[model samples]
Target chain A: MPKLLEISKPFIVLVEGKDDAEMLYSLTHSMGMPKDEFQVLQYGGKQKFPSFLKQITNFPEFEMVTKLAIFRDADENSQSAFQSIEHHLKSSDLIPQDSVPTHSGEVKKSDSGFAVGIYITPDCSNKGALETLLLDSLTSEMKSEIETYVTQAEKSLSTDRARDKYKNSTKSRTYAYSALFENASFHDTFNKRLWDWSHPTFNQLKTFLQAF
Target chain B: MPLVQSVHFSNYRNFTDFTMDGLQRINLIVGDSNVGKTGLLEGLVTLWGNEEQFKALPNTFRMSYGDYTTSLDSFWSWLHPQRNHSLTMILRSTDIDNLMRAVRYEDHVRYDRDSVERSLQKTPYKINILPIGIGNYEFQVDLFNQLANTKNGKESLVSSLQVIEPRLKGLDYLKLPSSNHAMVYADVDLDYKIPTTQFGHGFTRSMEMLSNLILSGSDIMIADEIENGIHYSALGSVWKAIIDYAVKNDVQVFATTHSRECIAAAHEAMSEQENYELNVIRLQNRKGEVVAINHNKEDIETAFDLGLPLR
Candidate 1:
């Protein structure tokens, strides 16, 4: 179900799901941002952006919203994902009707004078997702071990459909790594510090957030 | 169509230029105190209600008889924003000829009706505003008499009330030998008839609300703080009854609430229907001015589950 965003901070971030929300929550804290400076909202998924954005725009508390940021997966194409977020923002009249921001991490002024920013995961140029970003932050030894375990089990126990579905997915690989520690969720990896946040790989995302 | 399809307010009470469009049949207004939820209802009454309903605004505002005396100029100026005599309070609605407006300037108020309404100034339709902070006992006889006249409506009321209290069997309107006024009696699980006053306010208030809604024959019903008399537990059943009756009778309801339970119960009840018709309008104070934010069925459900601060 599409859930409404609870506005508790002047600056807000709209993420795709619980994993994305949890990822950003701890990631921002790792960057030394105050816990209350930004409110991370799980809008269910990228598919629910329309209804969820409608809820946010119609919420009375949104009057106090001075800044907004959208986090999505680069997933096949980073530019297209940024454009999609821009379309939804314009459709809900959150931004100027015809105005478009030039870059992925650029913070632009909304129609109501609030700052709006968009960031696609795994860097602005990569054709990957948050899982790819997470995997990049892990030690090469741990990454190789998790990958070997998933590959070794896939040939024996995986169905044809599962193989075809996850042929290029980092989600299964990341999940396998999280499972190594008693099968915690991908979001739980953040709290466990399974991913190194200080890595230069997270510089772009951190910059986008700090701009707000 | 609902009586007021959309509304616009300018210099009306706490609102300077607030407009809430896409009005639904069932609207529940939520806001912090002094956000002008009552003022919105009064604006509706000013546009759709009859002369009696207009005159009853002071009482609906919870003002005592002394506070509303004609000698007090402050009472009249208080309707304007900041009590500024220079500013005129204007309320416009889409129902009447695309431009039904009530302008309140100083102590003089005027409502111009288009050709569509032959009796707009003294409309036959009543707003049926059940006020708060006042005893509803004054209308027991009148409401009971109206309810008794319609057998089908009365049966619907009984069945709906049973959802809240299963023991309720029937309702009786009996007049005491000495007094001319009559009172409502509940023939519940007991062998004898007992006055509804003997029951809890939840039962009595629910019974009164449904009875007044069905019997009053008002196209619009404005209830202030609907959850006042009812307990939190019975909120779901009461909402179910209200929504059912409102939809079946084509009556538009505008109610205000301070309880989160009331909001959740309303969402639960409306979501049960195949075609959801619930709209939760929340008013908030942004800086010194107030604004209206309208939420549709799915929007309200999302806010409810997420525990969004709507009120």
Candidate 2:
């Protein structure tokens, strides 16, 4: 939790929503770090990313924040998503010039003396969101079974019905993940309690956050 | 200007050992209920060395509880939950020789400035203390009468009254023939004059507050729940008047508020004035120990921008 105070922190991570904030919070706890050492702020939504960036950078806390990381969903394309965040950073003058990370999980330090990192959901390998990333965390045996169930479920419905029901690839993947948690709500699947941080799928995100 | 730049307290109320530095001209103490916001104000009033305020402590507590039967021992019970401990407060200011200390003993409390004990016999030194709380109509009316007798006092009172009620034309005290005490009256029209009671709490509270500020005359003002009885719309102008008067008279103000509108209005008022400092101190109960989170102007402004609830 990021408190509104004059105290300085070594770094702060900005996420798009509550689920992302909770997951990252649990991840840091599992890594044996004190909760107060770093702060995680929920910036409300993807569209609010720019405004939040501008605010935090201009805020008095900016002097104390040595590193600032942003985490958002890749949605359909990781490159475009990364570009969108880069534009905000550039426009806010957090970074002097626009430069893409040569490799995934690379950290970029802006001209403002703050280390900046951008992590898109689904672990950089997939062109999807957090639900897509969680689906990748499933065991190979469980993955096969879920894929079979989703394929059969799609076939059972009419094409128009399937298109309306599933909508995007991430939606079906989210349903598949939800089914594993006793048919929990869509948000419950992303709960920190449901996450298995040891899974290889989260290694990239873990490394990137730990670098801060 | 004698501004209290920092305060440290030990074994006082909820605070076992708490210290806050970098206080400004106008400090708005805000936090959750029962976080010792009022206790901090009481501690300042105690240290500011006014016998009237010191003696009024018991009455203030009784008024808060709405029980006049409350004992003075109950007031002393605020000296830390642990027994046999002295409550100590150290207030430092910009002037090197202006530091003051207040200590509460088992039997009595002592106030000292520059290592000299403050005598109650003295003509209540230049540091005038005005504490504005609920239900102080009689005291306010007396002060109002004193101010009305002075050449400029009447004009100042009318001007301050018009801040809350623009139709307020004149203000005077009406002494009743049946009783020794006098009641406050507001002249809103030429043919009609209404008692202060009829004008409502907002008007009376505003009049009491502004009168006290003007009469305080280059001293510290302590107001608990400063926004009480005032409309949200009038907060901006009221704050502007407070800041302007405080600046002109070299009066330092310490007030508490649970209203976001009040804090916002104060920030707006302070920002418009040049070279005036506003600090918002947030008290938090952390693991049974009170902590003061001090925010400078820039921090408070940013907190407002982000919609962080300082209260």
Best by DockQ: 1
Q: After aligning candidate 1 to the native by TM-score, how far in Å is the CA of A12 from where it should be?
A: 3.0
Candidate 2 structure quality by residue, lDDT tens digits, B1-311: 43666777776666678887777778899988878888887677665545655666665523544221354456755554454445443432232245444445343455454243343232332444445444566777777887877779878878756755678888777776754867777788868567788866555666666776676564677778888767888788778777766776677778888988898889988888878578888887655788777776766664665555576
Each model's chain A TM-score? 0.86, 0.78
Evaluated against the true structure, the overall lDDT of model 1 is 0.74
DockQ of 2: 0.06
lDDT by residue (B1-311, candidate 1, tens digit) is: 56667887788777888887777778899988878888888777766666666666666765535333562454555667877768766767666345454534345454553332553553534566765653378676567667778867767778767867788888878886754867777778786777888876566667778887777777788988988867798788778878777777778888998887898889888888766888888887766777677877666655665545566
- Over all chains combined, what TM-score does candidate 2 have? 0.56
Candidate 2 regions exceeding 4 Å error are A1-12, A15-212, B61-72, B86-106, B111-142, B159-204
Worst 10-residue lDDT window, candidate 2 chain B: B87-96
lDDT of 1 at B147: 77
lDDT of 1 by residue, A58-110 (tens): 66667777888888888999999988888787677545553345678888775
The CAPRI-style docking tier of model 1 reads acceptable
Worst 10 residues of 2 chain A by lDDT: A94-103
lDDT of 2 by residue, A112-212 (tens): 55677888887764588877777777788877887777777766676886567664365676576676678576666555367677888888888998776
* Weakest ten-residue segment in model 1 chain B by summed lDDT: B108-117
